[model samples]
Target: MTKSDFYRLCGGTFFVLVSNARKPIQSKAECYNGITSGLTEPEALLALAKTVIPDIPKPMNSEMKTLKDNTRDFKACLSNGGGFFRFGDQAVLKSFDVRVRQDYKQPLAAMNDFMDEFLDIKTSTKKDEYLVKGLVELLDADKEIGNDEIFYVRADGSTMTKSQILTASELCVQPFLLGLWHYVLTVVRDNKVGKDTYKDFCPPRGGAERIYTKQLGENSKREIAITYCDIDKTDNDFTEPKEHIPGENEENRAYKENDTSSANEEAASVPGTVINNNPFFLNISGGNNSIYNHVDKVEINHEARRDKGE
Candidate 1:
């Protein structure tokens, strides 16, 4: 559907219901982008998954120098030997690495928007402490999570409680957020940076849990901009070694319609960087020693969600 079609098809507000109440956060509520409505999380996300048209806005000046390669924060993605798209910053690419994988452009834009919108979600909360307690207990019961793990949140307005994240993991189809989380957490655990060392990492309050970058040398002080998106955007303040660290294939698949196997430019392939190649579902933080070349944007298939347990 076109942008207007998306806007016309959506509802006023979106709600997520996982399990029965009594446990706060068992559901979540939010407004859509004033576009599609009443979309079960799946429907909204599927719509959001529409491929982006590759259009790398050109830098005004012709003689600018770029740092896409030398900069630690930027990561470039290539799909199936096609063109490449730079993530993190468009400005950086103009001066340093102006990759022209225009075909895979749509997926990069959509994927970034998808991931950004999913995480760091803003909502109105009702201050349900009881639900928080229950969630803490559930996390406490999780075997894979580390010992220092804890749920941290900050709410100001009216928000619901949880029966969702824990009790109804089955029904709670948080496609966008959970899928992004799966990829990120897998990267974090594999990198071992969030295990600690985060400036916002914390027993310290007021900050959300995050993974920080290690000191690259005796004179660097920026957090590395690491993520699962395919486009490269590094100004390189705190980037890690140039390496791929996922346990499975990381392809940039952006189809024009319901077709996953076909795309305009062979999809986006993030070159240079390789990640873990394992196809295991729920492998979570197991990409520590695994790294493979990712060639396209995330393949938005039904199986991609299943692989991520969305």
Candidate 2:
């Protein structure tokens, strides 16, 4: 079976086998919750598996027997030196009774061949360097966002401790690792610094038109026209007013007139005062005595403008 298929079918069994040897009994509700929600502890998961499948046995076949017997040894090899060694290969392969072909020159090679053939487990030539890199990336991304204090969130929305993630990394749990990698990428992408060029290709073709004009040259008249047409077709097209409220037009005109008169009066009172028709622009003028001299900046409320259909 493929690695994913094997894990899918027998992940619980493998967890029990590689976990603490003594299996505990769990309540029916706990078992159901553990299996369904995927938030239970490994020990609880093992307990639940046993409670559901009491007839589960070790040594069901030669392949299983080899895997069951050698997994601990393999784990030990990794724990001792953080990698497989030539000397430890024989001990790791002791459970596999198959004879190594004469063409194979080394014990490590023979062990790798048997493990791959029987258990779908391949020995990495890099000695877990890639796994370490993945773990480091995950941790770094977490730290970058000040999430180092928080537990890692799994794909199931359950939280995993740092130690749990580390253990899973060591065991090379494919699903967990894939989820963690995806999370790390998301974190990195979210916290990434720089302009988002992808949005230029999205809707609201103003940015796209500018990019196209700049890159393809202003001589491309047809493309520019097409870009303009696309922009006009969008929902943001404001060429014509969509709605008319009763007395709304008159109210706005009156407000603008009053605001202009107030501005004109204020300007008359202050020396060296300048006025601009655009409410969004600040009415700045020379002389420290001007009323606007105290105003460092002006801000426009776009939400209010949108509400008023400006």
Candidate 3:
């Protein structure tokens, strides 16, 4: 694959993964394991890419740096490693690290457009045009110098052409990108950031309830109701109970009606009764002697009628 084609296919994902990998939120050991494992078994990476690619930002035009400057910096970051170009130069790497971190926080659509412009093969600046011409001249010189020499070698000790190496690099990078993506998502979810976007990208946390809310009417007369299963009940057959204080058994917990006892051991007990722990459930204070019973199910019935005056 050509460089532009590869970027078109995996550029957004590659940028996100590499930027996040530089500063993993999880332990370094775990992050490394995720990447290495992906390299061995690339199926996971392909699966993740299918689900993740759609959400990744598209390439946009960036004003952060001039095209000429960015292209020069990009070329400096790469070194020909006999067969292929590999990342090199500590200063260039550090520069990219800072740029990527800031780029990641930019509005998704804008950042995506910037990446596209950054990777564009056609140059708009005279300086960048000269750089591209110089690169072409270097490639021509290499062809003349190594006309009979083998340049590309595979892990299995087989020979490959430069074109084949480009395609191989695409395959190799997928696994590494997959590992980084996994670690980044884990950190984001754990820290509870990007809730509005990443929540849909990653799997829901364990023991999280799937609540659905519905609106019954419009304007002032609208009534909103939420529906969810009480997964804590025995009928639900959930293996794990809701999180609570350590050493406190949920089964032994008691619910008191109209009693203001501070001690758990002294509170009155109601057998086979479950408490509604949902935050949305109304809790009446300054007691007018009201007790809300927990029900296993709730059904809402609504009917619409037109007024005679209308």
TM-score per candidate, chains pooled = 0.18, 0.19, 0.17
Candidate 1 off by > 4 Å: 1-38, 44-137, 148-180, 183-310
Q: Write the per-residue lDDT of candidate 3 for residues 61-111, one digit (tens) a residue.
A: 462233324322222221111111112333433433342244322222222
CA shift of 227, model 1, Å: 20
Candidate 1: how many backbone clashes? Answer: 65
lDDT at 294, model 3 = 49
For candidate 1, write residues 223-305 as lDDT tens digits: 22122323443222322334455443333222223354344224435332223224432222222233335433323234445
Which 10 consecutive positions of candidate 1 have the poorest summed lDDT?
A: 8-17
The lDDT ranking, best first, is 2, 3, 1
Candidate No. with top lDDT? 2
Q: Please say which candidate is ahead in lDDT: 1 or 2.
A: 2
Q: Would you list the rank order by TM-score, best first? A: 2, 1, 3
lDDT of 3 at 246: 44
Judged by whole-model lDDT over C-alpha atoms, candidate 1 comes out at 0.26
How far is each candidate from the true structure, as Cα RMSD in Å?
30.8, 31.5, 26.9
Residue-by-residue lDDT tens digits, candidate 2, 126-159: 2123333333332432333343333322322244
